[model samples]
Target chain A: MTEAVELWLVRHAEARDARPGESDAARALTERGVRGARRLRRALRRLGASFDRLDHSPLLRAVETADVLAPLASATRVNAGLAREPGPEFLSDLASEVARSHVARLALVGHEPWLGQLAFWLVSGWSVREPARQPAWLALEKGGALRLRGEIAPGRMRLEHALDSETVRALARR
Target chain B: MLHLAQRLDELRAHAAIARVGADSRGVHRARATAGRIAAWLDLGGWSVLADDVRWLRRGLARARDLDVIVESAELAPDARAWFARERAAEQARVVVLLDDERFAALLAALAELPEPRGKHVRRALERMQRRSLRAGDALERAVEPLDAAHRLRRRLRRLRHALEWLELPAPVLRAAQTELGELHDRAALLGALERSPFERATRAGRDARANELEGRLASFRLRWPALRGELRRD
Candidate 1:
């Protein structure tokens, strides 16, 4: 039986420009990205978001963000499967792994497109939810998560928060 | 046995650095050390795997197979491929065995051997130390600027908050507002410089510009706490 799990999906903060000939995996976070991560940590604290585990993409930028936020929550390992471009099969496998492990709440720090797709999968079903022009977040609660088990329609998952860069900047300024 | 001895010697070197106490040392020492090192290597996530015995045999022939192989379930396929290539290209394998006093003595003797080129060795060591010191200094300077920006940002935030809380004289408020805008711009510029490619460049021109910006940022950051404290007092 599948157990309920609260998954907090976070997109990595701003990062340094990718140097030519370097893999995306090697890109490091910028100073602003680091500060943005710290701001996210503080915001999560203020919001009282608690979790049992924290996982991040193996990519340096995502791992750094996860490291910054780990102290605020109880994250055990940084899983690489939660990287950018993780397909539906990978997500299914990950969800199954988490379910088997019985972890109640998990926070994942990853990249764009993938995150939006995962959110879409969780809420809408098969089709990918295109990432908003700006960084945004959706909270999938109740049956909203179950709908992601298969291909479903958009608008099925309730949009909890849609944060743009300006909103994030304002938050960071706070 | 010689190969195993050499591997054990390498393990001993690591143990020395790890400070594994003699009281806990035993036959398992080599295995434990190997296991620890393997774990570290696996965590680095760089390795290649082979499926068939043919490839594995070929890899062993070409690369000196280190006595320990650390494998993780989550290793990426590309990382695994890289590891495979590295193993296939390697010519020697490391063999680790438990501790031996005689082996330790041999390592000590090797260390005592006189340097063939004393002056060159000394100069190289000095250069390495100097480079390390310079890097540390650069890091120290970098933090100063970041801290300054952090403080100014915080102060501006508080002033805005205070403005929201009370009715202030228009001119005084206007002055504070104007100062806040300038501080914000300066903070943004400093942040941009911190992220710029020029910041990472070691060229004299870039270094000079970075140093100047760092100094200014540090000064601002250093004064912020006190400034904020004063504002609180008022």
Candidate 2:
């Protein structure tokens, strides 16, 4: 039997407000965002969590946040697709990427609604097409990250652990 | 303006704490903030402040390097003690740098700089992207691929920083920079370990690690062409 692939979906840290006339992607991380990322890195270290690969969104906030966690991975990549809104294509692309790579452990650093939606899809096979049938949303706060394990399929994965920024801060404190 | 001001305040606060004691995190934050300020200056075309910001960041690099080694590397007690001493020395140097008259001058200048408008950020991104393409061309033509690759890596870093300012998507550039960064870290760590006196066990581990990184670097080099192509389109 093949080893179960572990996927960690991480939301970007808290970003500062976008400057006047600046695009959303231009918003960099705030001081709290930097601290939150570092704390999450420490917390993951405590859990003996290391990634085979880490991919992040192309946005400044996600890139900066992922930079803090780079030491835990052998290599990192930017995934432009990661910045896309949650939908069937996003799910299909992610699933195919995982299946193609066959990475035992992968970490993705991206934005919120997408991260939450991916997690929901993985765990419950939630279909975004049916908005009316949408179950309770699995919301991920800024600086939060969660682990899912099992097959790489849409509904085959299981949520192993979830850590919000605050929880990670507490864990790091210990 | 607010973001810059807030970061400047945070940098000062962290620097003050770092001066009081040998706090690695404080020093790290100060160093990071300095880099961010430099990036902002580039995006804003605040060329006058760029040199000072670069100088500040370089000054903090040594202490940050020592902190990282002390935190991450597995070393014998004797080697650990040696690093601890080196860290103390770096901390002292950091104190002097912070107290320098130039540091005050830089801060005053930074405070007066105007905020970067959207147009400036867009222009910087376009300019940096062009420069990166030239660097890529140089890499292809250079006799020594390794040297050229290193230069390209630095160029890509600046380009990515500019891209970040505009939130422009460049997966190829990001991947290249990330891989290059890891490659640099592994090489530096191996070099540092090799320069130190360690037991046979440590040397063996270092060799194993270096071998692993070397393999990865070779593969990354092989992928560079494809990456460069995608980056050009990006």
Candidate 3:
């Protein structure tokens, strides 16, 4: 039997308005947002959550945040499919691409709808309530790192792991 | 009027001499000076048109040696009509000499008039030359910083492309780290989906793919920070 995949989901910090009447691609991370990302990086290190590969949204804000955290953990790559507005088809494609890679523990830094949906799929097998608007995190632990065949449920995930910047900072320091 | 004609000939001669070894900046300055000279000629009573003049090829043209060409007797009408046609075709005012015998004789007589040594004409020519030199220097200075930025962006892009071709020994571990980073971006998207009408009926599937990538990336980081740094730098 294969071990269950351990997934870590992280949301990007605050960013300035992208453009006056344009898409979110133009947005950039604010100073406070950068600090928050650094804090998260520290927390992941303290938690002993070692990642082998780092993937982030191609959006500038997400990319910048990932760049900050990547030096502390692993090599970072930008994946356009992980963007906030990806559809169901895109998520499925991402899952297949990831499955083929055979990574054990993965961390993704992206936006809202897609991440929330990904979390719901991982926990409930069916999406439950909407994911939190603020930075929310989910950790999944299943047996055998090769396939996600085990009894997957919300119980396997832990909330409040990365709810705020202060807590994340403390975790990093620890 | 005769003095003005001699002065114009001298200015044209000077312009022709300046065109040798001139770059784009130098050419522009020379053309501007020629324009000013043409403007002064218009103020005089000579029916001379400086329109459609090939300022760039001034020194190269054989016609520069000839003072005037006569093809007809109506000097003003023929010269004005040729000037209009040339200007329309070239999109610039060019100089043309009339084809009238009397007018040509008059111009020949004027060309013999003693040239003026006015300081204003000399000063204007010098200023145009100086302006061209400044423009050339400014262009040289602007390239360095712009090149640096362009090189950095290209290096980063190449590194990203190279990663696609790598087949690491521990694929699962690499996949996990990659997924973790991806999850960060996706989570933000999920947060926004709550406000939209395109709600999904089924949650995205729980997969082990992301975890494997993260684990791989972590292991690689521990083993090869130096390579990663090199990749980022280049």
DockQ of each: 0.01, 0.01, 0.00
TM-score of chain B of 1: 0.25
How many clashes does each candidate structure show, in the order listed? 15, 0, 88
Count clashing residue pairs in model 2: 0
Give the whole-model CA lDDT for all candidates, comma-separated: 0.45, 0.75, 0.43
Please give the ranking of all candidate structures by DockQ, highest first, separated by commas: 2, 1, 3
**lDDT per residue (tens digit) for residues A4-94 in model 2:** 7888989888899988997777678899998988888899999889988787776778867777888898766556667776677665666
Clashing residue pairs in candidate 2 (N, C-alpha, C atoms within 3 angstroms): none
| Superposed model 3: Cα runs more than 4 Å off | A1-3, A85-88, A128-163, B1-234
Candidate 3 CAPRI assessment class: incorrect
- Cα TM-score of candidate 2: 0.51
In candidate 1, what are the lDDT values of residues B67-98, reduced to their tens digit?
Answer: 11113232245534554444433322312111
Distance (Å) between predicted and true CA of B110, model 1? 32
> Lowest summed-lDDT stretch of 10 residues in model 1 chain B?
B46-55
Provide the lDDT at A103 for model 3: 57
How far in Å is the alpha carbon of B153 misplaced in model 3?
20
Better of 1 and 2 by TM-score: 2
RMSD of each: 26.0, 22.7, 32.8
lDDT of 3 by residue, B57-156 (tens): 3532322211111111222454435433432333221223222222232233233222223453345334433443333233234454223322322232
